[model samples]
Target: MPSPSGENPWSIPENDRLSERDFGRIAELIGEHAGIKLPPTKRLMVEGRLRKRVRGLGHQSLADYCRFLFDGHGLTSELVHVIDAVTTNKTDFFREPTHFVALEEKIVPALLERHASPEPRIKLWSAACSNGAEVYTIAMVMAEIAARHRHLRFSVLGTDISTEMLEYAAQAIYPVAMVEPVPTALRNRYLMQGRAPSRRSEVRIVPELRNTACFARLNLMDTRYTIDRDVDVIFLRNVLIYFEKATQEAVVSRLVGHLRPGGFLILGHSESMIGSNLNLRQVAPAVFQKS
Candidate 1:
């Protein structure tokens, strides 16, 4: 129904649309800062995502919000929020089951066999961990292995550019439906159900597994990463599709530098074409090993 002003209250005002110039500027900013492309076709998505920021800042339209962001000295404070708004963070527990199977059956045993120390530590990183699912899944696998192999120690690191996601990851809470992909045995071992009525639909990662994982905010576009250089495995999955080829190559190369010799680098199945030029050998589908 139309409002008293003779406009549809449920409809967005025409003036709220993002102008082409603003969209271009936003695209440029996001590309330069995050290495993720935002072509003209993504303008609607960008506009829709930024609407929350616009309303939060009390702006009447996209133009006003952009002006505040670009011209009125809001960029320094608003840039992270803008990037968070536009970034896509679709993920699931055990999104690709094969990757974990290979990690367990092949990667861990191989790394352990090559270790020189009597007690060795295996480190796994989730390079674009969205909400901690992948890292927790990794911890679960490692925990089960550690049960039998008393001399083995493992830690998992989950990193993403989104602080919001980092917070969510650190909280280690997830909706019941999101964890259905987890196996029954691992789920029973690593997950704890919420007891209260209002929280019954949620599950929290077991503290034992949570202690084995840590979360950090890291940007892939940076020339250097502050992470350790001796990581045993790095999961750079399901994220390269958002980058251009050059950015993909650069990010993959930098991540490879962090891997120890013989360490594994795993990409999403769809991103297998990337990193062929790097000093890596294909070990399995979507998996590479640094020499």
Candidate 2:
């Protein structure tokens, strides 16, 4: 039933009445702007994610929100929030544990052996590092390796397309429960408890760890990366599924160019490099070494 005074479509129970043409329009524009592809299979998901934004912005429907965004002369102001809502940002401590395993067991030792002389400077990039779980994980591993090496230094760089996510990454604060998956020894060494009773128990990354890592906003679609210097390793995991094949190849190629010779490039377990023409050799499943 409508309001006692009159009907209100904005008050309707369903906000998913997105038309086919509008879906295509929104998907195309998002791809053009953010390099995020919204296929037909994601039409429902896109609508669901946009509903809250549309309602929050006081639009009656997704169609209206799209019209406002596409037709308005200067709706660029709202585009940021729209992209933030649509982008995937789910991450956790030690996500895909195997990658970390391979990192510690195989990659680090090899890098250490290869650059054993003169105390090499280890540099790592966590591209699309949402909220910094991956960055911290890398830091922990480097800290362990450093504990033994004594002379080597490390710098971990975290980058993402979302400015909001980058802010959270820089903060390095998380609920205590979220960091449980991190090993106990590393936890004790690198994570400090947040001791305020008023707030729920949480953990802050130790200053030593935070100091070694930095965050930046970066869009992977760009032809040239702003970080021009060669990096020793790159952890670009679980982000390519959002792009088309051509995009995946392009991104992989770009990542390869930055890797110092024989540097490691780790992708999500499910992401592949079968046909990618990057100058990389598969050293392990989903782990490639620049040629």
Candidate 3:
């Protein structure tokens, strides 16, 4: 039964057919504008995520919300929210721990030998560093390595597209659940577990580890980024899956451009530099060294 006006699609009850088309249009628009690729088959998931956004904006219909997004309003904010909601950020301390061990055993030593000084400095970038477990873990490794070497200095800069996620990273606090998987020694050394006087429980990163990291918001799709200097290593893991093939190549090219010659590029275990013509050669499983 249609409403009195008969043209208000909002009044037409929500159903599979209605959602499918709108979702496809949204996917197309996002891909065109931001290089994010969402398959048509994911229409239901997209609708489910955007339904809350539409309701929050007090739009009576998905069509209205879609129109608002497409009509040249401040839609980037909503799109960022959509990306944050849809992207899988499942990560933990020393995820794919072998990579960390390899860095400790071989890469760090080679870098130290190359510099041959009392204090050799390096900078690493954690691209798409969601909520910053990876960045903090990188700090932990640096600290541990520095302790043994007594002649190394390192810092990690973590960047993400979501402000909400960056806020979480800045606080350097996590619930007990977040620290449970961390190695016992590392947890004790790097994380301060306690409750402040006025509030709930929290685990804070110690000053030594916290000082070694900086977090910021950066849209990888944006060509005019502020990262001015070359980086020694970049962990651009698991983010390319959200992009189309061309976008993936572009993103990889941009990331590779930031790496110093002979620096490392690390991707997720399931990710690779497929279809990307970067000057990086695979050195290990999911690890590539820039040539």
Judging by TM-score against the true structure, name the best candidate. 1
Candidate 3 positional error at 141, Å: 0.8
Model 1 TM-score, 2 decimals: 0.95
Which 10 consecutive positions of candidate 2 have the poorest summed lDDT?
Answer: 1-10
The most accurate candidate by lDDT is: 1
Superposition-based RMSD of candidate 3 using all C-alpha atoms, in angstroms: 5.7
Give candidate 1's error at residue 83 in angstroms. 0.7
**Candidate 2 positional error at 111, Å:** 2.2
* Model 1, span 105-163: residue lDDT tens: 99988998899998999999999998888899889889999998999999999999998
Better of 1 and 3 by lDDT: 1
Q: Looking at candidate 1, what is the lDDT of residue 62?
A: 92
Off by over 4 Å in 1: 1-10
Worst 10 residues of 1 by lDDT: 1-10
Alpha-carbon deviation at 70 in model 2, angstroms: 0.7
Model 3: per-residue lDDT, tens digit, 110-148?
566666467888788999888889999888988998998
Predictions in order: lDDT: 0.90, 0.83, 0.75
The estimated TM-scores of all candidates read 0.95, 0.87, 0.83
